[model samples]
Structures are given as C-alpha cells and as structure tokens.
Target chain A: MKKGKWGLIIFGLVIFIVGVTFPVWYGAGTSAPAPVLDMDTPVIKSMPNKKCVEDTAFIRAHHMKLLDAWRDEAVRDGHREYTAKDGRRFEKSLTGTCLQCHSNKSAFCDRCHNYVGAKPSCFSCHIVPEEVKK
Target chain B: MKLLLPIIALFVVALLAACFAWAEAVSLLTILAYTSFLIFAAGFVYRMMKWAKSPVPFRIPTTCGQEKSLPWIKTHPLENPANAWGAIGRMAGEILLFRSLFRNADVKMIGGRPVYGSAKWLWFFGLMFHGSLLLVALRHLRFFTEPILPFVNGLSALDGFFEIGVPALYLSDAALLAGLTFLFFRRVVLPQVRYISLFTDYFALLLIAAIAMTGLLMRHVYPVDLSAVKTMVAGWLVFAPVVPANAGVMLYLHLGFVFVLLAWLPWSKLIHMGGIFLSPTRNLINNNRSVRHLNPWNPAVKVHTYEEYEDEFRDKMKAAGLPVEKE
Candidate 1:
C-alpha cells in the first residue's frame, strides 16, 4: 500500500518539531551566565546602612515598578519622598537617589538588564552622570 | 457534576505543585518538565507518523463550490481547489484566518419561525485565543534565548505597547483571558454545547486557565525574580539544567500546569493542532475528475475471462444444443 503524501507529511512533521523544539536548537551552545552586578561604588561603600530603599529580593523583583511609580510621583504628582517599610525616607528620583549609590550604570544596571535583554528608556531623557562617564 | 470534577482535579494538581514547591523540590519539577516534553514530542511524532502511513487512496476533498471543468465555467479556486498551490492557499486561509469557521451559521427562532443566521462569535474568540496563544508562546523565547531574538523583542514591544500598569501588561495576555472566558462561558451557557461537553473539554480549559492565572499571579500580584526564571529556562534549553534557588511556588505551579498540558496534549483532543494539516477533506485537491486515483483498498482477484469460460463450457453448451462462441 502507498503511504499517503509522504512529502507533505514529512514537511509538516519537520515544521512541528522545529517550531516546538526551537529553544533547544537556538540555545544549543549558548551560555547565559548570570550577570555579575557590582556593588563596589564609592557612594555604596560610604553608605551607613549599605542597603537599598527596599530589601534585596523585593528590589530585584520589583525595582522597575518602584522606578515607574517614582517617575509618576516625582514628575507628575510632585511627591518626591518615598517612605520605606522601615520608616526610612527616600527621595523618589532614579538619577538623584538610586543612581547615586549605583552610579556605575554599566556595572550595576546594565549587567542584569543586558543579561535579560531589557532596554529600559531611562537614559533617553536623563543623562548618564558625567562622573561615571569614564 | 462534570464541571466540578475537572476544577477539583486542577485544584489538586495545583495543590500538589504548591506542596512540592514549598518543599523546594525544584529538581523534581525539572525532571517532570523534561520527561513530559519527551513524552509529548515522541507521542506527537508517533501519531503524525501513523497518520502519514495511513493510505488515503481517494481524492476526497470536501468541495463547496463549482469544480474546475469546461473552459467557459467559473470555478472557486479556494473552495474547490484544482491545483496543489490553490489547495495550499486554501489550507493557509483555513489555518490562519479560519475561513470555514467564519462562515458558521446558527439556527434560531425568529417571529415563531426557525431562521438560519451568522454566528461569528466562536470564530472570533477562537481566532483571538489561538492568535494570542501563539504570541504568548513566542514571547517566551526570551527566556530560552541567551541573546533574545530581535523579532521576539519587536513582538514584545507590540504586545506591551500600551505600557499600562507597572511591568507593562502584554495585550496578548489580556486577549487570551478574554478569549478563554468567552469560550468557557459559551460551553457553560449554551445548553447544546454544555450537553456535548465532556471531562477532557473542561479539563483542558481549566488547566490552561490555571496556568494563565498562576502566571499572572507571579507577574502582577506576587512578582518573582524574572532573571532567575530566564536563567532556569536558559539552563534547560542549553542542556545544563539548573533549578533556580528561589523559583517561587507560583513559578512551579505555572510551569507544572504547562508541563501537564504538554504531556496531555498529544493523547487528548488537542492533537487537532496536528490533525488539521493531515485532514484529507481539507488538504486534498479536488482533481479526481482530471486525474485518475486508484483506491488502494480494492483487491486484485483471479478472473475467468469470457474466452476461458467459453472454452471451458463449449462441450456442455454443444451437447445441450446451446450456441457456443468457439469449439
């Protein structure tokens, strides 16, 4: 008995396999080592608490939300002060507050952002600090 | 109730994942993912091969319009394709745009008389659901890709173009939920559909809904470390699987549900995804009139020819005074 349309059948099967198992082939030899974030900035070293506005885990997961909220509050509503969980007050400014300690943008922000391919438009309007230009 | 069973089963599955996640059994989850994927892939291939090997010895294309014939006659190329390319185009239209489903009709009472009217809701929601699912699946390429593909990035940008909410909600996610809601409610609300629905129907829907809900929980309600998620996915893709130290309970639940769906897909009605392509009625070209196709099921038999019959029965026919063709 003749097999039904072997050419079309094989083509369809190949497409299905290639499409479903795309990740395996695409990342076959790729090594996505986690980006090593640097916390050795002069401002970070001089900090008393040596902590961010939130805990490490919270910041790691939701720093984008915090930054977005800060942008809205500071620029739109004129509320520049953020009250942390521990009653510590922080100025809700990315460049002035967050970037002061993480001044080395390439080392601090760019690492994880590049690792995950997140191209946030923070630097579109705001300039990278001149101090950390080199 | 039939509805209650799938919901309860899904809940139990979720609870199982939650317990495992609570115990930090990430390796077990990884193993399950790998095993489920292997089963899904192998089963899918086996099923497709079975379909491929089945002999369809007839040009049984479901023609809906005038077939190609006499020079003066008009023919619908898509509805009744005469050539391979036309058939392919028809398949593309059916697969991508659901051309046939778009022509769905419903019977309803109008002024005490039965009337046939267009019922495009299933087509609409089905397209929405499948389209969004495709996009959502494509969006996950970022997790597996070391350097994310530009097309995936562009797709993500388009999906999250609205920039609503923190973390930027993907429009596909919302559309997927809306589609699922409409589809689920249609089964529950329409008595005709509800009567025909079975356990697997509700199970498939609920399982997907659970996956989506758990994913949303992780994204908005309880944000997980995305970098870790990406790392874990990348690790799996590269064959050096690393269980994230803190993949969170929601991640496991979401991923566990997905693995379950994958494992169940080939063995369930979801195989229609592959079956649609192989369906003879849809894929075959209506060219039986133009070309001869021998049915393979027809068996060859030993034949007694007229000459042989005449030769054998000539003596008997001559003796009985009946006319014989030959001596």
Candidate 2:
C-alpha cells in the first residue's frame, strides 16, 4: 500500500502544481479592467455643493443602507425630510435628492461603482439623464 | 492531532482577522480570499488526481448483506453490489444520501442486558448540516454574477421564503445552526466519540459553526452594505478587487474562517469527500469468483521447481526408502 501510494503522490503533486498555477495561463485577461468597466471615464470637475448628508467614510460603506432607509422613509413612511448628523436636511429620494449633487453619474457614480464593480438597481425603476462625458 | 494545535491554529486565524479589522485592511481580505481559493482549487484538483491515479490491486468490497451465491438464496443487490452498474447505483446512494452513515446502529448494555437500536440522529444532523451548507454556498453566487441569474434569485427567495424580517430570514440559517449544535452535543455526550475526538475535528466543526453564526449575525443583526460586498466580490472575480471600507469586522471574520477551512481541507481528513469515491472497499465490484483481479504490486516469489527438488533429493529419498516420482 505504501509503495503504491508514494508513486501516486509524486505524480499527483506535479499535477497539483500545474493546477494551482492555472491563473498564470488564464488570469491575464481577468487582471485588467473589463470592457464594460471603461476605466477612463471623464472625471467630475466639481460638485453642486461640497456638503453631503454624511461624511465620506460613512457614505462609502453605508450608502446603500442609507438609500434603502431613505426609500422606505419617502415611499413607505411618507417622510420626505432626512436630518443629517451635521444638522443638514435633505429630501429622501434617489432621483430627487442624491442625484442633485451627483448629477454627472457617468463621471461620479459609474466611475466608482464600475471601479468597485457595484451595480445598484436604483436606475432599474427610476429614470435619469445620461451623463455626457467631456 | 492534539488539543493544543487546533486551538492555537484557530487563535491564529482569529488574531490575524482582528489585526486586519484594526488596520481596516480590506484589501488584505481580498488578497487572502484570492490566495485561499487558488490553494483550495489547486489542492482539490491535485488530491483528486492522486485518487484517480492510485491503483486498486484487489477486489475487496465490503458486503453489508447476502452476496450473489446459490440461485435459491436471495441476494441484496443494493447493499452488496456484484456488478459495475450495481456499484454505480450504490455509489450514487452513498454520495447523495450518505448510505453508510445512515446504516449506523448502536449496541449497548442495559441493566446487564445487550440491546441493539437505531442510531439515525447522527445521520439526520449530518445530512442537515451538509445540505444547508451547499444551499448557502449556492445562494452566495448572487455576489459573483451580474444582472443576477434568475435561478440564483429563485434559490435565495426559497431559502428566505419565511420573510420574517427586514432582510428576510433564510431557513438554511436555522437548519445549519440546529444541525451543528446537534452534532456538537452528540460528540460531547457520547463517551466513545468524546474519547476519540481530536482537537482538529472539534476545531473544524467549531470554526464552521462560528462562520455560520457570524453570517446569521451579519444578515439579521448588523446587516452590512451588501452592494459594497458585491462590488468587492465582483472585483475579486474579475481580478479587480475593491474592498469597501464599510464592510465591517463581521464580514472579515466570516471570510477569515472560510479561508482557514479552505487551506486546511487538503491537509485534513475533510478530504474524505474525494477519497470515498476512490475507496477500493466501497467502489470495487464484489465478483472475485467470477473474474480474476490482477494485483499490480504483487511481489515475485523465490521458488524451487518440483523437478529441481526431486533431482536434488533423489539419492537421499532412495537411501531412506522414501517414495520418489523419478524412482
């Protein structure tokens, strides 16, 4: 049994090395940005206003949750006003409020979302003007 | 092999996870995931190759019931498969439903009397644990695909069909926990099992349980930004990982445990998943009388031919008056 197995282990380890290094053969294409994710999209030169409902870190992590809460507030609970942590208030609607500052979505939204590979379904229901890249 | 190593191994995983959390090093998590999967896939393929390449030198099948013998005697076809097709059917049963584990029966002494009874609870929880784990893994494909496959959506819907909360309660969550708890308790309760249980066995089981618990916590308790998670996963899939700053410590902890599972799989007995199929006792056909099975590793034997023996002992045989063919 030992004699039989040792031969197999030697032959199999060689194959295992080949199998593990498969990324070397097929990973070249995957390493670069995909065609769908156009990496060189135009950048947003400026925003309508510098103030956001939440800070950058919170917005980066909890944007979807905040958006979901905002949607429930506006549509389900009939509350339109959202008071931010810094005493700023904004309307609770994706198209009406969030889109006001980040109107250039191709440059602002698509760039980051595409970079991070996030495809939010907000636009599945709501209509918005396409951002014309400069 | 001992209690200390697995505990220390688990502690190392936990400590590494904490450091990542403290540093907010989400990219490190992504890198860990990539490397973990590479090793897992490679090792899995390697082990499978080894199994496939290994030679079975004898027809040694374990027969659980009456084999094919006299025409008058009834044979149990499923339990003691005699042919290749029968073996296939049996293998299917074993793989899909764990037929061997299902056959467990406990014999015990009760008040100085011998008693035999069914031990099906182990089978039940084992099935539940494995089945729910597969379902949960399948449900997680939502993070990898774009425009979400309808089947994936359908699976998630079915898993969370209860609709109990904001995020919906996945039924597998409860089943997994119940199964793990039952299995763990049984291991602790049974004296024989407790005595034989190694630290690695407990460590693997507890690690998976912790992973499942953390997953439940993330879902029903402190739901993370799934969109952000999807983004990171999609990036990982396409070689463009973007670890979201918002993905909290819980997600990292869960992933850390999974990474450990993947890394330890090839080295551990968990590899029995692939080994069972290659097992000669389970996979071989029980038709030794009907067919000659060659032993590939049969060693050559040194022998004295009858002619040579007769020639060498002829004088002695004649003198001693022993019968000899040549004489």
Output the number of the DockQ-best candidate.
1
Predicted candidate 1 versus true structure: per-residue lDDT over B245-309, tens digit per residue? 66678888998899999999999999888888888888888988888778767899899998999
TM-score of 2: 0.72
- C-alpha TM-score for every candidate: 0.92, 0.72
Q: What is the lDDT of residue B180 in candidate 2?
A: 92
Encode model 2's per-residue lDDT on A8-120: one tens digit a residue.
55575666566544434434335433224222322223644555679866775567678878878888989999999988888898877777666666766775554433446
Model 2 lDDT, residue B80, Cα: 82
| CA lDDT of each prediction against the hidden true structure | 0.86, 0.74
lDDT digits (tens) for residues B197-315 of candidate 2: 98878887888887898898876666676666776665775666776646778888888998988887877788776677677787767888877766767799899998899999999
Sequence-dependent TM-score of model 1:
0.92
Question: Which 10 consecutive residues of model 2 chain A have the lowest summed lDDT?
Answer: A35-44
Q: How high is the lDDT of residue B183 in model 1?
A: 90
Worst 10 residues of 1 chain B by lDDT: B239-248
Off by over 4 Å in 1: A1-4, A75-77, A131-134, B307-327
Model-by-model DockQ, in order: 0.65, 0.13
Candidate 2: docking tier? incorrect
